[model samples]
Target: MEIAVVTGGVAEIERDAGQGSSMEAEWLALLAALRLARRQGLADFVLLGDAAAVVAQANGAVRAPGAMAAHLSAFFVLASDGPAPRVRHIKRTQNLAGIALARGR
Candidate 1:
């Protein structure tokens, strides 16, 4: 899987994700981006992704399935370490990270 991060409309990180289900990959990408933001000392930022289910689960709008429960928990724990996390769902075309990944392919 391909994972990418874009900040301020610029590509900040891109990487190949190891083997996992699509849901797991989405969670991994979100986690990776949050970790990077924390390292950069960012206190306020919004995370945008094309995965609607992951975003909904992250925002507590829905409950994650059993396989994704741990990931949802981990996201909350990591997000609590800094400012409140704002995760939003966007169309694939509106996601820069998705665009970048497409270009890489």
Candidate 2:
């Protein structure tokens, strides 16, 4: 899982690969950000992810599957008005904290 906390152009990203396993851990991070952004009433924010799910969810064009599907389904219950969160695919080297977190997890 990877997280990029940003207020403006500046952001600090934290990441970890849980069990040092598959990339699914990264998806969890995206899910966490989606949940957080929705809770924060964020009409717009920047998100970093290696998967397309972040972009798809923000655009309301794709739905999460498996265990994450349920939470993602509930998340959209709120009004996600305004532009969707900006999603940029970042390299692992740029997502330090996220990489670390995924590993730790």
lDDT of model 2 at residue 48?
Answer: 71
Model 2 over residues 29-86: C-alpha lDDT tens digits? 6656666676667776776765566456645677666765654554454324444556
| Candidate 1 global lDDT | 0.86
TM-score of each: 0.90, 0.47
Write candidate 1's Cα lDDT for 19-74 as tens digits: 77988888888988898889889998888889999999999999999989999999
TM-score of 2: 0.47
Off by over 4 Å in 2: 1-21, 51-83, 102-105
Best by lDDT: 1
Which lDDT values do the candidates have, in the order given?
A: 0.86, 0.55
Q: Alpha-carbon error at 44 in model 1, in Å?
A: 1.4
